[model samples]
Target chain A: MSEDFYIVVIAVLLPLTAGMLVAQRNPYHALVIRGIVGAVAALVYALFGAADVALTEALVGTMLSITLYAIAVRSSMSLRLGLLAAAPCDPDEPTPEEPPLAQPLLKALRRALSRHYLRLEIVPYASPEALQFALEKKEIHATCIAVTEALTPATAQSAASAPYHLSVRLPRLLEIVQNGVPPTLASVSLYRSRQMTTANLSDSPDARHNIWENQP
Target chain B: MNGILIAMTLALLIPIYEAWQDEDIWQTMLAFASIATKTSIMILVVSVLRDDWMIGLVGVLILSVGNASLMLLAHVLRRMNEL
Candidate 1:
């Protein structure tokens, strides 16, 4: 009876443990815990005579946890501080000369957009709702937003449905806006495409062999 | 703030319900719920302790990465177990 109960508990607990590890606040830490849990779970499965499940869980869980942790850390640390700077000279109170900090950030944003051939527009506003309203009204296509303002349901929902895309460039106000599509989705799609292309390019030779090897 | 809280709550509850029905799905859901809860907690904590903007931005990115990882892990695990 004790052995049967242990089997049931192991079967139930392994996944729950994995889930808890993944949900940890620090993903880097989470991955470490996940690896430890995976190893322990594998041992339990082996003891229960579920060697197949044990082997797969051990290998896949460790690989995935580490990969995910690396990716998360890379993205978080890679955020550019220049992007989060303040918006240029207020349209309402145009100073005769542009601030030194504003010119380069603005130019950098312009160049980034030009690479995608997106038209850039800037609007002066004190409130995010006003900007979102402008976006809904089709006054702008995309803009950089502060993360605090961006997370609002109104802002997030408006962004999801807005004609213009919204993005947050850390440490600056040089939010880039284009004409129709939101930049967020466009950027994500672009990154995914690049990843796929790179994967295909690297795997072509191996793929050919597998195809040939599998052919009867 | 209120709105975000509500959204996070609803997002978490879906997986908790799914977990109740299927042991396999429950495991997966448990993982998801754990991550979502942690993210929400982090966002709330950061909002209180530091700049709301910085933490919020980081929170969203973390949430996305966490969800993506969970989904990928579940799929891979499922396939491997099949063999």
Candidate 2:
């Protein structure tokens, strides 16, 4: 009984680390715990006299799989945000002023995205048209522009309250930005291009930039 | 020999517990590093007890190579934070 006691205890660690892996909420955290699990599992295998199995578990299971999955998770779990490049204030200087409130909004976005284990990637477009075009083309997951850019005579009063406007293409992203971002900083909305509008270019000029206000 | 393995197992629990509760990613990473090293060492001890050359060789390989995964993961994680 004493001879086999250590084996039983070591084998129990396999399931314990696995439970920790499953309990982990963050993908990156889960990946690290998975490395722990693999190590423990290899030890268990080796203890049972399965040296080949242990070797395979340590090399292919822990190292190769974790690296590949890290790449996959890093690439897939990120939010790509397109913004208008700050226009040069002076022709000679050519130094563009960062958009007003861009810093605060970005900070809030980073905080929000971090909670979800998502990275925020900023892509700058030369103009509002380009920003909107990228959204329509699915080039970016979302676009943030000054509210003034999208304002028409009718919405000029109501939209003026918010300096910046964020238009997200995906519904889930819209929800995340809406819930995570504060109302004072930017107004979040869903912008789904009308299927017919894309098919027919003769649609009204503002047809492309339709910003459906999803005010909570 | 059994007493030493038991003691090592007890020591292993410390890092596992640290990993379970710590909020910081780096702290959890530290726990992983500790756990990886400890497990490899435990394997080495087990190999010696059994007098199994194959298991001993496997333990040496793991001791050397297991940490490579940790370093690769750390680089990737550090890059994630910088961006």
Candidate 3:
């Protein structure tokens, strides 16, 4: 009877830790709590004289799953942003200076992504055309392009002041970057790829270009 | 025997609470290390109480191996921070 009492008490930890695991919002923290849950479960199993079960729980359940989940979470939770590669310059070579907002924009992006527990990875393309193509192909989630010349009178004022325009393919990501970055540093807009637009718009190259030019 | 086990269980609660409440990943890692070792030791105690050699063997194996996994997890976490 007394032995059963202790066993029951130890067994209660399983649900307690499981509850804690369910309550965790952070993936990494949840993984650690999972390890705790595994340890408690092993104790309960061994307390019941299930030696094999306890060993398996310790070996495979705790160690293997935690490591796997950590890697999976690390790899999946990231935002990939495409950038225009800087033109070649040498020590003696005089090239146009990088945009003044470059460093602060990246800092703001990192800060915003970190809030969502996401990492920002910048992929540089050789030309603006290539960057646009990558965004259309969904090779990247978002692209940050410097406005070399104002394309239309509508955006000229904002483009002149902002200097950078961020075109994001995903609507949700557009919202995140919009809220995260200051408007003075960059203007944010959503880019709908051919697949997402109507079939008639997708049929004509000119219509597609018009859609790209029309983004707010 | 029951009293000793109960005491250890109470002690184990300390790190579990720490793991739950702490937000810093490293502090939670420390709590995990503490819980892993304490639970293995508790397993060893239970094995001794029941005079079960099989369970004792499992306990010893977990005591040695659990820390190895912890080290692996810590290394992975450290590299994550570096990147």
Candidate 4:
């Protein structure tokens, strides 16, 4: 047979054989057969000086087909459940406000006193100096600032003699103050006990102690 | 097999159209016919041997890739010859 005849024959037969082997439920054997055919075809093409055609056949004929068959087999056996459960859910409803346990110390004081005193408010001032001024002027009863703010020299000096008390840290205080309720009991217990003076106070007294004791 | 027959018929018709228009594109059309004929024959043989539909489906993919490569090679050759 002519070199062209042989090349044409192999090209036609290899894929047919591989597809048949796959249909017979033996992809591993098919893969081996396909690989050998691909390598032989590549060698034959190289000898005949048809390098480009050989390369394409080797990739698409053997490698790609084998990989695809492997993936199909694996997928058939163990289909992924992740894709089925990937749909998004509707957003949850907004919760209503409760009391001191649900709100921040500052917000709790504002809400608790707001009924008796009409214009009671809790504003989050960036500068502790402003918060100190408000506290001194009795404009705001309590303030909630970050632990980092309390560490500043000016804040420390001002808070030393002032009637102002360092409320629990924002994250810990958030637990008690969530859903727009003030944490007055937690703050009062925290301030009155004075057992621990660090800025890392938790929303609950127990949680605050846990934070202090386990300073991670 | 169906896709290959369709492509081969199209390939055969292209040369006739080029010949009718007196266009210089008949040679290119002839090259397409050669590759399409070979692919069509291969598809027919595989479809008969297997007695399955998937063989015809795979024949479509193979024919597409084969014809595209042949066209690219012809284009490159034409450019080289022109140069």
Candidate 5:
């Protein structure tokens, strides 16, 4: 009788705690708490000589629910992107209130990927060589570097070409570049974060361009 | 029986307090697992006292499969976090 009483006490206490845990705001913890409650309920049934019930509870309640909960949590988070750009901002264009280093493509990313919480990190690479090395090593998600003119305003319109040429490494960014968004849209301050990468509308890219452009 | 009950109560309290205070994904899952284990044990005890094989069988099921889901979910969460 005493043993039975103790089992009963344990049974009650377990669910009570499970219930409390379930009440938490975090779904992750709640899912785990539900598993605990399920296990305890199964235990209570087994103590009462109902192995069949216990078996079903063990099979259904504890395992399946936790996995489902995990999938749900996994599906809900945002994507992470690494960008590197070095494009000259067209002085004639009106500047926006974004950080000084914000490139046109960066602004485009903020607009395009706004629905999901996009964690766009600007990885700094010293030269195009270093940038390419980082991208090859999978350090940066994508990279953009100045193709034609360096940051020398002294040689400005004199030896300048008619159109600007940029190159993009990642597929998702191709759409923003193809939209003909000029390199002039610069808001991100260099002092605000770090350096930048700019790759856009460059025609001389390799085979990777054809496949990624069509990925959609 | 009473001692077991006390132990279970303490077990429950830890999860409840931890869940309330900590927001970590790992700790939360662990707490839930602990609660599920204790509950299944209680069910097994109940099935024995009732002397009903059907009831006992239910306990068997829970003992066997109850924690599987939580484990699976934990694995998924861990993988997703890696991304």
Candidate 6:
């Protein structure tokens, strides 16, 4: 069975080549490639008439390891925070030193979060509504809006007195907000984000006939 | 059998080449899995030719559990990086 030998050799090399390609690109995706290697080994086992071994490899190597890897990847943290900016209603006020805003508080937060094992990425959303939409879509972990009765968009006139509304879904972040943001000047407001529903006909492109009928 | 064994032996070079070329831990794990799979299959073949299913069962065990433990180790290392 020289032809069988050739087939076995080909089976071994194919997955090895493919695994090398995928692993070289991203280690994250390599978890999937590892399963492929396992399946190939199972195929080889089956070819040699080791049926029990083949079944075990297929079940344990190809399936279980991949599932564990997927879960592990999901558990890792990559925080995306939203900062919504609103334009000041006044423009004629004389320029003084820039409003401190929440920069100092956020700096302290960065250090504190590092100690707690988290990465803080500040993403600026154009408007409060956009930020709100992103929060609802779960595109962002949390959103903060400035209630600065400001002189300019860059800095509030009285940053010390500037009140901010914070909305968050993550428990660790909620804990950070409770302890981190200056409570005297900052008012943290917690609100549940609205999840999108497939039952809404008005949300669909073809069905704009009625909006009130679908309210639930 | 000698020719078949040589083919499997040559398969070992792929991972050595891969490990030399890539520094990423996941890549290294993937290479190890690939190499383990190859070696396990070789063991299976040997056991089958010798008419001894016992050694083949051991090969099966490695084929099934080796990648999983390696993957678990990789995941732990990743979580450690986060912590």
- The candidate that achieves the highest TM-score relative to the unseen native structure: 2
Cα interface RMSD of each candidate: 16.2, 0.8, 1.0, 17.9, 3.7, 9.2
Candidate 2 chain A weakest ten by summed lDDT: A207-216
Against the hidden true structure, what lDDT does model 3 obtain?
0.80
Compared to the true structure, candidate 5 yields what TM-score? 0.48
TM-score of chain A of each: 0.33, 0.82, 0.78, 0.26, 0.39, 0.42
Candidates' C-alpha lDDT: 0.43, 0.81, 0.80, 0.39, 0.51, 0.59
Off by over 4 Å in 2: A88-101, A151-158, A195-216
DockQ values per model: 0.03, 0.80, 0.72, 0.02, 0.47, 0.07
Query: Chain A TM-score, candidate 5?
Result: 0.39
lDDT of 6 at A176: 71
Better of 1 and 5 by DockQ: 5
Decreasing DockQ order of the candidates = 2, 3, 5, 6, 1, 4
Best candidate, DockQ = 2
Ranking by lDDT: 2, 3, 6, 5, 1, 4
Clashes of each: 15, 0, 0, 7, 79, 0
- Candidate 6 per-residue lDDT, tens place, A1-216, comes to 764565556465556656565655444446545655665566566556666777677677666766676566545544666764333312344332223347765666566565554556666544444555667767778766666532234333333454665667777678876676666545554556555454542444433311222233
Q: Candidate 3 residues A1-216, lDDT tens each?
A: 975677777888999999999999988999999999998898998998888999999999999999998999988888888776564323453332333338999999989988888888766555555566667877789988777732335545556778788878888888889889999999887876654334433454442231222323
Give the per-residue lDDT digits (tens) of candidate 2, residues A131-175: 666687887899887777762343345556778888789998888
Candidate 6: where are CA atoms >4 Å away? A1-56, A59-80, A83-124, A136-139, A144-167, A176-216, B1-24, B27-31, B44-48, B51-83
Residue pairs whose backbone atoms clash in candidate 3:
none
Between candidates 2 and 3, name the one with more favorable TM-score.
2
TM-score of chain A of 4: 0.26
Which model is ahead, 1 or 2, in terms of lDDT? Answer: 2
